[model samples]
Target chain A: MKLILLLFLGQVAPVEVRAFDTPYDAGGSITIIWEMDTAWVAKVSRIGIFRASAPGLQDSLIETLYKPDSVYVDNSAKDNVPYYYRIVVYSDDTLIAEGKTASAAVSTQQWFNGKRLSVLIILIIYTVFLLYFIMRARTNKNLYIRKIAGLEAIDEAVGRSTEMGRPIVYIMGLGYISDIPTVASLAILKRVAYKAAEYNAEVVVPCYDPIVMVAAQETVKEGFVEAGRPDLYKESDIYYLTSDQFGYAAGVDGIMMRQKPGAVFLQGYFYAESLILAETGHSIGAIQISGTTAVTQLPFFIASTDYTLIGEEMYAASAYLSRDALSLGTIKGEDYIKMILVVVILIGALMESAGIRILTDFFSIF
Target chain B: MTTIIWTWVAAFFTLAILSFLYKDNPLYKFAEHVYVGSSAAFTVLYVWVFDAYPKLVIGFKEKAGMQKYMLVIPLLLSLFIILRFIRPLSWLSRWSIAFTVGMAAGLGITGLTQGFLVPQVQASFLPLFVRGETVGQTVLLTMNNVIIVFGTIFTILYFYFSREHKGVLGVSSKVGVTILMLTFGASFGYTIMARISLLIGRIYFLLHNWLRLV
Candidate 1:
């Protein structure tokens, strides 16, 4: 089998490299093209574009383009400096062939200069505002924040689960642990674990990754210890259920049906399985509070879960949970930025409608 | 004949993904394991053949003149990763974790400044006036620009948290929240459309590309 695989790969022709015109009128970009051999093309999966300053430069790999096409455009290159590009063909992650270097020189154009300037100014103003608020918050000055009703309901959810003598099931979505939303999800889990510990309610966490399972177990253990219920902590409470997406979903669904937890906390990044889990939890009469940055899944959660935290709210879970002054201050700063955005949008709209160029011209100053 | 076989493979994958609607089964399990194993194996093989072997190994041989020594770093790293199976020496994996985290943080900070903060903020600013434009057109452009700028600013303000919300600042913050919520709603709508589009595209491919139904 291995010999056959090697011979098949050897028969595949190397990628062909050529320079071609980029799609857009933008002159600074150039496309690199290659051809796939017949056998390889039939089974070919994706092409990877490796870019560098010159050929044989090991440390200069700048980017990888993942696409099935034999061509890719280097759109972000600057004029005057030459760029060397290489292409690699892969089938299911196995490298089938490599292409030679194609060099391209970029030149700037005159079009879109006006639009670009306006964009630059607006970006500067908003950035300045963000930095100002961040500094203000950092200085520990008093910042007013509105109450989040969902946050207030956290205690109620835990207490209900406790009173009902049912477990509190917390499931982090399939988002990578490194993502901000996933971190925020873990922060919420920390709070939930603490509350559950205080209520003496069992907490079950079925994770999709071994790494996440480890982090969650540690966080839950710390939460229980802090709540003076360390004795209730069990390793099995936070267990690795397969890393497969739908498999994990199935395992979680089974747990929801059998354990029949009182409160189900769904936090983190979720995809299609979100609705399935929430609907199941809803059927079992569990009070479900869900938070995710996956906008596509938000509607499903909103329809099924009792309470939902939208977009940035998930990122603010730490602030809401800990009420840490710094985090809260950041939230307040974000609010100020939002307000400025609204006013600018309204004024821009009005000025455009009234045939007054001054408002827009003034805004262009940034 | 080959096309038919490929079509069958694709159809099988599509059905395997859709099978979750009914429940998990052996077919789904097989598909899932195949995806995971193939993806991981493919990643390793690609890195070896394309990245590691070409750039690091062969390039070093041609240019650096110390191919044998240069191969040591990656070899050791790969070895250490495999040692994760050993219970006691697992802590050695921290080196990889630290390296990954450090690189990610560095890249993130640089990207956040150039890709996000700079361009987004710059795009927000549009002069209140432009020369040689009609009054109505100018007004319309200005209003749109203002909304964009205002939205960007207040949204950032709404995230601030050093002080208490008691007075005029409180009102501004509330407005910020409203703008942010609207943005969220729009984003949510767009995302739903995007995912639905992907689903449609997949179904279209299954029908047209595979089954020839279309």
Candidate 2:
């Protein structure tokens, strides 16, 4: 704040403008700011801003602002294009003070953003824990993942199918081969397929994507080989049905009707078709176990299925079932990361309560 | 006249799907086959014409110097996808899968942090006391904020895996489950509303388009 007495003075200090590329942005934006003289600011009628794309070109008048104005952001400047800015102060159109930046401000792309430094740090910490735990697990350290009811029941579902002399139907929901949930679901299917092979119960997998069908075949075959039942593994058991959403649902529903499968496993990325599949299984009186990360489909599974794995549970199901060290270690690492987030939120709340925004401001950077 | 024919076709398929509520039948089977066959054909055509053509043919034709050479990256990646069909070369598809999955994780982390983590954390902070407000409003506002802060924290606690969920952790997880259940219930209700509205739209289509009535 400048002293109020400065308003009566003939001259105010020259406007100092600082122009730099906007942080955390893709590119092509430059933020401009000029220091304000709060006291001398009263006397100034307006300030006119001018910009030139490159040096020696005529500065185009961009904007004008009245008293109390201190900043003007020029976003029209293209990336790699040099920008020069001039700020002119006027009292009733009579120029009182003028300043122009000597150096050109050019917007450049930043691969690593300074603003997301906090998020990057948190990610690194989580990754370190994940790698360390995975290493420990690979070395045969027992990582105790909690007893997930949905996973434990997989054995019972497979056994029941075997005893009843019925086939088990596994729908690896409607996700493409590349989806994370689909990957996790495939992991769980390995365990399911192994259990089915061990018990000599037939397991049929109907896939939406052709690539997923291929992956499913490999997984089930590998599972049977691991279970020492490779001879029992049928190549045609896992097949690509259709890619159409409702058509796939109809196909699966038809299998549930005709085959009357004893056990049904629904996992991966489901959509509006989840209700159709789960509700049909319910009506068929099959022991249905459903899991997915799709929040919208959770209720249908929960309402109709015997056991439903909630969002993260669907991803963690394979690790819990197979007790793999690396996967278990990764889940533990994610837990620790969640704890860190909780701490940050608590500290932010405390700061906000005290009217101190230091912590909250840091979190808001991203 | 052309539109009328298409409308009748669409209406026929729509009714075939709706027949699913009664039982799976031959009519439903026909619609299912037609839908799958047409959609697969459409996807192949769409990918070839829109994406594959421009990225490959046009890049080679129009791209200059270093830009043209850079097309080899995508070209090689796509070749991995083609390898999936060949029995011996099938394992080579892992390269493309790894590239895609790796990119998805990297992109997901960035988006999740910016879109979910930061905004949600900032939003969780709420000032308890107002400098100049009635006591009732202050209590209500403070209570609202307190519930938001606590609910979010405890719900996240439920997902923890290192220490077995027992003792104090167990209590927190119980609360977390409650919050999660409430969220699922609300989401289910919301989805049901949207689904019902879609049903209404189909019903209107049946009444107006198929039957030609009000």
Candidate 3:
């Protein structure tokens, strides 16, 4: 049997094996690749991957592949550690041929992932555009920003609330203070709260988060101070409700029902409770303006609210309401970026249609 | 006996909450207050027990060297945030807030680019024309790709705030709005089904768990 096996093994060439640290990764992984004569492939029933700390040490089998797979990644390797690898080809239960790496491969943590180079490039370009547009906007104070109805109705909403002798309710939805939407909502809150203060109409804010409640209090205070009515700033009005989603909704609904506010501003991130709050506001006959980046809840806002800021519109609200040169420039820069993205998509689609995958490959090379 | 009492209590609260559909009254108010008050208290306890105790107290006990020292930064930042209550030292809280805001911005940019932008743009790069086994299959694939390509472009154009919606932009935006509305319609239906399922669950609980009717 040994003589017959030797003769059979001698007929096929040794498989070429290479082991190396996986690139563009944090670390702790090694990739092993093997190439063998195609003619000898049919005879191989399985391949086994074996690893060891050193060349002289006994290699322990890590994984076995039943099929003729050419590549395997060993994710169990330790970072900054050298590893020796061996690949064994087996016919049924018997080892027929084997290959080993010429030298040990060391898995090292990469300082930077080359895969994210494109994202970094895009970000740098966007920053440059934003800075340039901001400079331009400083000189040309008349930078054009298309009108947003939701933002425009702020004054009107406040005025109506004042006329009706009713309060204005501003509910920053279930978002942590760290959320960008919540930050954006704070900006809009400053403006709305300022208007309410000027009109001598109360702006009630029921917060979902304690941190957000504090932020809202500060924002509303600033708004009141700016409106020369610091005394009207009620810290008690902008209070934390409950952390629970449904509980927050119930709390807000109760506030809306009890206060019967003339205008309601639903802004920031919301979940399933979006519709509940919006519908309650609607039922109370409050003129509702809702804004969020939550795609799942936008339809609920649209169906229930008088004015809805969809997706990016909410992001643009701060700049739109403020009309500040720096903010407007950023918005313009973002719009230009959107245009570039559109052009890139069109070009990529065209290239893909022509069966030239250059553009597709460029985007896909993570 | 305790299980039966708890079930009865749960049933009472459920009925009280359901009564809000007809009109707001004392029962609904009682349930609402209970829910909010308990949830707030529960959340405080939950955070202290799960997040604060484990990550801070246990981490301090388990970690060593640089890892242990690393916990100090977060501890100090958290302490600074809590300092907002001190009127004279309130400005110190801004440092912690600034750190949070900066971190959020950095994470947002990287996350949007890596998670959404790159993958979305790559997936949108579909062959406009496909040659399949049959002419019908080929046509269908081609149409699908066309819709995807155009839909993405038009939808993006709709959100372009710099340019006023006019001419080609207007037409494209209109198409985009139509597609968005259609998507919203489908989403509405899907979400309603989920909400209905939740309602069904509640109904099942009332019958099976409480009344033993189902």
- Separate DockQ for every predicted complex: 0.10, 0.54, 0.74
Residue B5 Cα positional deviation in candidate 2, in Å, after optimal superposition: 2.0
Worst window of 10 by summed lDDT in candidate 2 chain A? A1-10
What CAPRI-style quality would you assign to candidate 1? incorrect
DockQ rank order: 3, 2, 1
Runs of candidate 1 exceeding 4 Å displacement:
A1-146, A241-259, A270-284, A293-304, A310-312, A323-366, B1-103, B129-135, B163-167, B194-214
Candidate 3: residue pairs that collide = none
Which one wins on lDDT?
3
Whole-model lDDT, candidate 2? Answer: 0.84
Off by over 4 Å in 2: A1-18, A24-27, A34-49, A53-57, A61-82, A87-111, B109-111, B128-132
Better by lDDT, candidate 3 or 2: 3
> Which has the greatest TM-score?
3
TM-score of chain B of 3: 0.95
> Best to worst by lDDT, what's the order?
3, 2, 1
In order, candidate lDDTs are 0.70, 0.84, 0.88
**Can you write out model 2's per-residue Cα lDDT over B1-214, one digit (the tens) per residue?**
9989999999999999888788888887788778777777777787789999988999899999999999998898788767877979978877777787788777877677777777787788766554437888877888888788889999988877667789999999999989888989999999999999999999999899888897
Model 2: share of real contacts kept: 0.53
Using TM-score as the measure, name the better of candidate 1 and candidate 3. Answer: 3
The second chain of candidate 2 has a TM-score of 0.92
Backbone clashes in model 1 = 106
What TM-score would every model get versus the actual structure?
0.57, 0.87, 0.94
